[model samples]
Target: MGKHSKPSGQSGRTEPASGVRVRPLPVRSAVRLGRPSDIWHKSALSAVVAMAVPALTLFALGRLDLIFYTAAGSLCALYGHGLPYAARARMLLWVVLGMASSVGIALTTASLTTSAELLVVCASLIAAVHKTVFDAARLGPPGNIILTFITASAFFVPQHLGQVPLHVALTLGTGVLAWLVCMAPALLRPQGPERIVVARALDAAAGLLRTEPRADGVRPAGVSDAWHATSAAVHAAWRTLYLVPTPTPAKATARAGLERLLMRAESVLGSMGQEAEEADRLRAWARGLRGGGPLPGVMLSAEQDVEVLGVTGEVSDVRRPAPCHPRGVRPVLARLAPGSPLLPIGARVAAGCVLAGWVSMALGVGHPYWAVVTAASIYQANTTLTWQRALQRTLGSLLGLLLYTALLPLIHVGHLAMIALALACMLGAEAWISRNYWLGSVCITPLALLLAGFGSQLPARVLIADRWIDTVVGAVVGLACCVAVTNRRAADRIEVALERVAAAEAAASRLLAAGPVSGAEGAREVGWARDRLAGCLAELREAVEVASGEWWQRALPDERIDHAQQQGHRALALLVRQVSMPAAVV
Candidate 1:
């Protein structure tokens, strides 16, 4: 792989590629079972607790009609579990407010008009907004689906002008409770999120260490994947640790211990050879991070502390403020620019939601909002993922219909029974959805149906028939829009990503040419350069994966991409060597 020009005379495969290959439609991978999130119980437990208290209270008061509003608030608990306490608190605040605002808008719109066409347009636009904002913010997992679901459902509910505030108030109030529930764990273990992230870095580094070294002076098949995964984990650990405030000594000490563990993991990653003992030690320390008893004391001497190469200056200082990267409102506004790639996704969501809802309504489906949700849920970063979601959603929605039918007997027993049953479904949805959307959908579909029957109970036949129709219509229409809407900017993003990697690599090269770095200041600069290049390479990989499946996009410069990645990683390896083995000449 040459940098200036591709293999001109010859055209053939030579080296292993690092980016995730985009298959047309990965049906098996989409439907396949996978490991759950490491902290699945956090979201699962919080969602149940958040719902049960309010739902049971409403049930006792004969106010089950307001269950939807409280449920909307309660679902906010499902987010921010992976963030540090400081970050999580801020994130959850915005999420709760966003959820309430979404529902409030829906309620307001429904109160103003009975026009289905108008409602469809409003819902689609809101879905687009939710999708766009959530992606720009990079709030992981469940994405905008929950917001979409609650908002769309609200639009169809019978609303009067006066009642909107009360309903929205219920949502905001329960959302407050949810915020508390999620933040409670921080009190028990203030360093919980930081510890978990470090543990993850350790595990990822250990996995990389366990990879057998290649002897042919050529890249191995899975080595790049392992390398990128390890790199991402290590960087994520650093970012999370940087976000944690260390105002007190105890907090500072906990932060320091986690930093040492992370440094060890990063060192292991920088060392390209297999070290079985080192890998075992990392895993041991990772396991020790399970509970909040004590930090894993991976001590570093004063001399070793200066070995903080490949770190940002702010990160080099324990008391420094969070990184200066764009966050909160600024980056989100920038991402919402007209020419942004997210615009196409927003376009897809808007088109799909409207079309799905319209078609469902034309068919006289009982609840067309379900179809709207199906459309909103399927739009992923690329069309390949969108197709997969369509399939998984279809399968799960159908299975969930069956589950709902079985539970109908018990649910009809009383309002209390229905409330209990709905809570169970909520629990299962959060727990299982972490592994695969469809598995969770099996539980989720029923929960939605039960919630729909809240104010006025719909018959089993009507509920089943309505949801089935919506699911099929939504999947077909949404997938059609995904493929039809052209995303011409996908390839362009890859190009920009490539340029970033090139610039970062150039800076790193300049640092490498400065001979062996010494002193805290010089080493810190080297570390920052390394981190910049590593982050750029990671972005390039993401851009490649995203562009791979886009329709009607410019042909990707595969050779150029491969060359950049290979050369960039080669530079990184040398940079790591310079940092880790200062005595060895590159």
Candidate 2:
């Protein structure tokens, strides 16, 4: 995609033994709109309320100038929406800490120093750390953008040593509030998050079942996408259920019921019985799960229920399912270890952010943090995804400027008007961002402009012009850094992923060879193998897809990877069938 990209050999010829095939940027899907999340309102409402409470408090005290600090905490509500309440609680607390820490760092830096150059350096490095840590922790959407924005802006915001503690305390307080707002839903429906995901799994599995089976009963080849979606959704649903901590007897009972529903859903997805009819049943169950309704039940004995949860009650006293900690700190730490792809991305972020911020400062834009944030937001999983963000951010910023221009008059009417408008845009960004980043960006741009209005007294035209210039500068510089920081290790990651697939396939094949055995225990063993192989294949596919987009990576064995995936899936299907028909085998 750039000057740094290594040329593959002649077209239609074998690549050099050391070379991997680079994937072209998929521009179409990058900008394409996707279906909105089923529970998007959870986030939209959380953000609006989170922001509104603090805004109102500030307005009453005539301390709206402190809104910038509070905005950092309010945005914390945006993460962990999809996590199980048990896991969400831990993740939200970390998010709260991360938000405060990020703000504190920026505020401290600004107070300790007055050099714009030094601030740019400090903010750039912080942006890199934010990018790396958040990606590593898997703290989902809004991702590091909001955190980076708050930190970068805090760096530029005028701060004095005396008031540093006050600002950080304000942010810390609001972060606690954001955490409360996010966890409030758990009080009403303890398993609401788990139920929603299970229903999504049912819906996705139903899509897979909607296709007609072949005469020989094999799945049609073209329905792989549906199969993949179903498998991923089911996998996620199972994980969510597993993550539900049963601290109390009541919570354990709720989890047990959820496990039954998920098993039924899984069985329906894997069944060979009337596809259309099974699909309808799955959809019916899914609809029933949408509210505080009774869990759709399946006919399973107490022993069978225990088995399906991957536990052997006979050995429950001696052996138990391994515990998964709510705070997933291990993976977070691993992502920063030597040879991680995220490290190189962090390098790109540091370099790009510094360059972008420097250019903006040289250009005399009052808020170079905008440029730093623009750069930070553009670095996604791969260059293709990064390119998409750049396009989205630029276009969104332009359209957002137009939006801000239109709303400028109302914003000028009074403080109440400005506050109301900012709240609406905050709500809109969360509502639309899930569908597509750019759509959210349109609302985000104006929201940003208004936040500036709260912080400084810059004229609307200067804010508009400076934002436009900084955006263009940031996007261009960020892309350059992406090209410059080529990750050759991407190919290595794909190779490792392929090895995992081979290992999983071999394990599943050995289990399938054991023949279908009697009882839930045997069935559970086979089911475990099936899930493992499916997961490995999913990872392999992701690794390949990400590597393909890189300009520099070792040559991929395309035919070998395809064969591995095909064999892996075949093994998975056999395991699934054997586990589903667990009775009467050798």
Candidate 3:
């Protein structure tokens, strides 16, 4: 095949060299624009599809009020659901719960008191804490500021206590419609193609680690692209997994095994820092020779042919090197087994139970419609992400409210064109403004203004005032909850990650110790080990950062963990170089 060189628009921004014309987006601009191709397209597709059901339902019933509920509820399904375990499911549940709870809280407060400003502030604060703590607060990109509209506006929403149940039921019915529309059609059956892609990723990462860092070979540009593709594939796979029921024992087992193998490969490669300059060049040359195609020959052992590149006509016999093993490595090598333990059913059950509780409580409260929003925000694979999201929600909402208050009066409420303009702004909010929390808030302000317009047309300034007050309340409350509900201790999480690293390093050591073997099994073994080690190293770094942050609250033995992690990093780097090119003879 022919070679094509192009930049992969990946995350981590890098400066363009002097001659390079490609200009990267500034972090701030990127965050503000919020890559329409990434978050927006995914979310808007869900939202637009979901809107169909409600629009049709309202068309049949001739009740525009119901459409509002439908529109609100359906928005729930437009979030990031296809992420790894706990993240999608948990966040969705939180959004639903948060929406429901905020509705009730806002309504109750509104009904009991005449202080509209106070109620808005109180509601915003409560929503913020609820979002922050439980991870269920799903107010969307601009955060809980939308809740200001839901709550403070409840004062004038024209409803009796008796109508609460029916209105809530209507809203939830729409929400369910939204949920079905979001998930039912697009999902893959059995396993997604992404899974196959993930498997391939495991193979690619392994290849990089096993090769000695050499300067002789032309670096395969594809290597960077391949690694990125793998990461995206893994992320996609995990997201899809969370959306569905937990995998069966067989599937889960297979996945676990693959995960372990990949981990081992990562660890081994990580042990090696940058190799000698000549070796690096040689490796890069080899990569260039192999470019635009599958691996040349069965698998090249690290030692065989120092010549990196070869003519296209002669693909076979590229270079076959002997495998490398570490000293006294048998015990560690044995651990690189294929097979994963089945995921616990109890975890699934717990997740479901938590989801259900939040849903029920949200619906039971006065402003139950807000439940959808709450349920969506709270679920996360790690509590750290959940906390960050919570803070974002609180801060974003406050910002949105302030913006709304200032801008509302500038727009005319009576003009239908203005309403249309507001809707357009909302779509823009949904389309952009996802990169950073505060930036998204700008879009959210107009969206809320539009949503509120659905019910009544008060003076822009008055509506703005109410919005700011409600946002304040929800943000405060959501943040408070974040502090209250904490799980998955950071220290413990770090320790577990270290343990995994240790296990991977040990296995790679053993593999290196074993003399080189020819044929398929030997190749497979080496490939698997390489993959596992690389993953382990990456995860270790992630775990360290997470643990460090949480250690502040829980007080972990930071010094010990830090020292161990640093040692692991050094050892892993060395190991990578040593194992890059396998030797033929023991």
> Which candidate number would show the highest lDDT if scored against the true structure?
1
True-structure RMSD, every candidate: 5.2, 4.4, 14.0
- In order, the Cα lDDT scores of the candidates are 0.81, 0.78, 0.44
Per-residue CA lDDT of model 1 for 257-348, tens digit only, reads 78767767777656866678878888888888875556555544332355431243223345222244565689888877777888899999
Worst 10-residue lDDT window, candidate 3: 340-349
Reference-based lDDT, residue 304, model 2 = 43
Which scores better on TM-score, 1 or 3? 1
Worst 10 residues of 1 by lDDT: 1-10
What is the full ranking by lDDT, best candidate first? 1, 2, 3
Residue 236 in candidate 1, Cα distance off native in Å: 1.3
lDDT of 2 at 226: 69
Candidate 1, pairs of clashing residues: 310-527
| Model 3: how far residue 40 lies from native, Å | 2.5
lDDT of 1: 0.81
Model 3 spans with C-alpha error above 4 angstroms: 1-39, 52-68, 81-159, 184-419, 468-500, 503-540, 546-586
lDDT per residue (tens digit) for residues 1-586 in model 3: 0011111231222223432122232233222333343335556666666666665556567665544555556666665433432344455565555555656555555556654334434543453344343222222353443433454345435555666666666556666665565455335333322233334444545455444344665455554444333343333333233233333655444343333322332332333333344234333433432232222222223321212112222222222222443222242233222220011111222232233223333433333223223333432333333345445555666666666655555555533444444545556566655556555656666665656565655666665555554343333343334334443343455666677777767776686677653454454455445445545655555545443333113444446555555555454454444434533212
Could you tell me every candidate's TM-score relative to the true structure? 0.91, 0.91, 0.50
Task: Name model 2 segments beyond 4 Å from true.
Answer: 1-26, 212-221, 272-274, 300-306, 309-327, 519-524, 581-586
The reply for model 1, stretches above 4 Å from the true place, is: 1-23, 214-221, 299-304, 307-316, 319-324, 581-586
